[model samples]
Target: MRQHQNRSLKERLSNSAFCHFEQRGELPCIVVQHPGFTASLLPQGAQLLSFCPSGDTSWIWLSPTAEYQQGTSLRGGIPVCWPWFGNADKNSPEVQAAMAEGQPLPAHGFARTNRWTLTRLYEAADRVEIDMSLPQSHHIQSVWQGDAELTARWILTPTSMEMQLITTNTGQSTLAFSQALHTYLPTTDINATRIGGLSGHPYIDTMTGWQRKQQQGDVVFQGETDRIYLQQASPLRLVTPQRTLLIHSRGSRSTVVWNPWITKAQRLSQFEDNAWQTMLCIETANAADDWVNLAAGANHCLSLRLTVE
Candidate 1:
């Protein structure tokens, strides 16, 4: 038994060594080898993780979890939550309750927790693809009997990044849903930076003592800001004096931006102290109570590509 175990270990080591050797070349995809940077591609999309050695800048993109952890929670990297998209109720009751009946999932639906299968891995280009079948979940099947295909493709370039999500309805009936790419970007100071894009639109302010009002210019961060802007036609941009990160998307009809200031951040133990200043949530989504109905044999696609300059 001991000898067998040793052989197994040796085989595993040999496989790893050979994988590394095969990856060393002008391959189209490559895994990032830096201390805090790792890249992978599934049948869905490419996912990149960039963190400090101290584990501070750790960010994950499931390429499939696009809802941005709802408007309430946005500290744990950028999750692409999907299906029943945005808020059904702006104030009380919240959207989770509205989705309780006849709905296959909770507020933002159950796309995030499902285990995605990796279909392809490119060693030279740092890319991966993940794929999942929707309406296949036990909960979803009980509520809505249908089959859907969701594919997420993530590609990491030397200077920029890209993610694509494609959903196809394979069942006989139509599928109704909403989607979003929840992005949580790390920053030195959220207050110092201004979020561009929705310059002249009205926003429902979720901060203390502030009434819902129309924003005059580009949305700037003074204190804590959490609002879901309606019918925004512009792309989302996180602008700082030092750098600017542009989030461009297609097939999404709504956009959400959120930040938990000092008080809210303190209450959440996972995000303590000045963690608020280090992160900002800018999501590209389809919400505002909008439902997408895809007929059988129809497919819908949503994509968000980020470029940091």
Candidate 2:
């Protein structure tokens, strides 16, 4: 029996607002709608496709250029990058390592490109809960050679959304990996928006020769901005003309902020180059120097929440 079997479906969906499976575009999806919030999930990659709160625009950004084809990573929304985060662009990146030894790597790992099983969904008066998992299997073990299982859970309320990723080592050997909830957030104008609560924190500017610098104030964008801010747990605020977004998290040691700006934006599928001003990415992560090492039979959980004010 699977370890997740211990939790029955009835108990899991007892408080769910409403859960159903339906076709979304070209893919089959699980859709959840409650009083003030609505969300959709694709079992492929267990990807979160959309999230919206009543009276507010969609906070999660799904690229118009994103491909829905199976086994491909969508350019937007929250692509759960596991066993690694981002591309192995740098020499000796953490995603290419395991148990102190180098291992094969795929950009953002294989989690987001594979299918996930829906384990449970719950409907409640005020919130909806969802659970999806990818268990250890021959194909999964073949890719990373780690006997592990991954589970993703989400709780959505009228005004907020939360997601958690739990990984357990089911093999006899210890396993190590880095990960992120690469959340693509929407905005009215990327250039005019400012991110507060990270002033004075240090970050690595990935595009500027990977230079390390301390923030002067709330982060603002003028051009291409791709940075990894280390060890900042304070809530993040996105100030835009139309609305304000509050992003909070637990079990996160790093926050990555990115916007392809003009140059890189044109290279993405399903994304219009000029549309760069419409979205920004503030990811929750344990990447680079902060990878996790799990002992056999052990588990770790990473979580995040989003609210609008």
Candidate 3:
């Protein structure tokens, strides 16, 4: 919201060949049009709305019916879930303690709804670098009293894209929180999709009463599926008929895989009733037993990388 910052952003973007700022639908977004790929970024939530390598369908699936209104998160791309994940009651006691008693907590925290300031932008022959941060304000403190700063960095290349969410505890107290890079990936067919590298891991089946279970083999879609894999660090492969996407992560122990097949898809916002057929969410996370705790002046980062072949 700083006038000088906006001026700098406009000036730099105006001088770029591959990147520019444009109004998409109802929101202003940054657009990248490199010879190798094209991507769109929204300042709200610091979200990547779309990314497509040259000659390929978009790897990031955005709902056709999605609205671009403010304060509402779009149905796809990488939604940054922070401070706490899922429900307020489901967070760790320390994280839950930060919230006011008897107040309703929004799912996935408030970071995604608040606008972030673009702090850095750089473009090169082979890649583009972008950095943004959430400015601290009374609106943030009213929900979670802890003082924390969040920054998002994006690195884009011809063949791949990487995102990093950095959290710094700027205040003088210990803080606890959970977060995720909720990436919605596109698939030619959801039923034909299989996720590898989680065969032997333990998971919490949120769809089945949060039951603890072990994965039998590759994960495949049937009905609605929602599972939280615990302590996961290995790379995962999302295989479909047309192509395969390799997903890598760092600074995260938990991973979440979700798909709303039929029943729930109709009830979601910014989503078509049948939109679940083409998207799957495989999130890199610090969640549940793997929640993060940062001492004063400490910082933590959660990153995700995606490559398609």
Top model number, lDDT: 3
Question: Higher-lDDT candidate among 2 and 3?
Answer: 3
Per-model TM-score, in order, reads 0.69, 0.88, 0.96
lDDT of each: 0.53, 0.78, 0.88
Ranking by TM-score: 3, 2, 1
What's the candidate order when arranged by decreasing lDDT? 3, 2, 1
- What's the true lDDT of residue 64 in model 2? 77
Model 3, span 1-309: residue lDDT tens:
545554666776898879897866656788999988899988888899888888988888888887887788888989899888989889889888777665677999988887788888888889988999998877777788778889999999989999999999998989899999999988888989999999989999998899999999999999999999997956899998889889999999899999999999989988888888889999999988999989999999999999864
Tell me the alpha-carbon RMSD of every candidate: 8.3, 4.3, 1.7
In model 1, state the lDDT of residue 277. Answer: 74
Model 1 residue runs over 4 Å out of place are 1-37, 40-75, 86-105, 123-135, 142-146, 204-213
TM-score of 1: 0.69
Candidate with best TM-score? 3
Q: lDDT at 255 for candidate 2?
A: 90
CA lDDT for candidate 1: 0.53
> Per-residue lDDT of 227-252 in model 2, one digit per residue for the tens?
99987665889898778888888777
Is 1 or 2 the stronger prediction by lDDT?
2
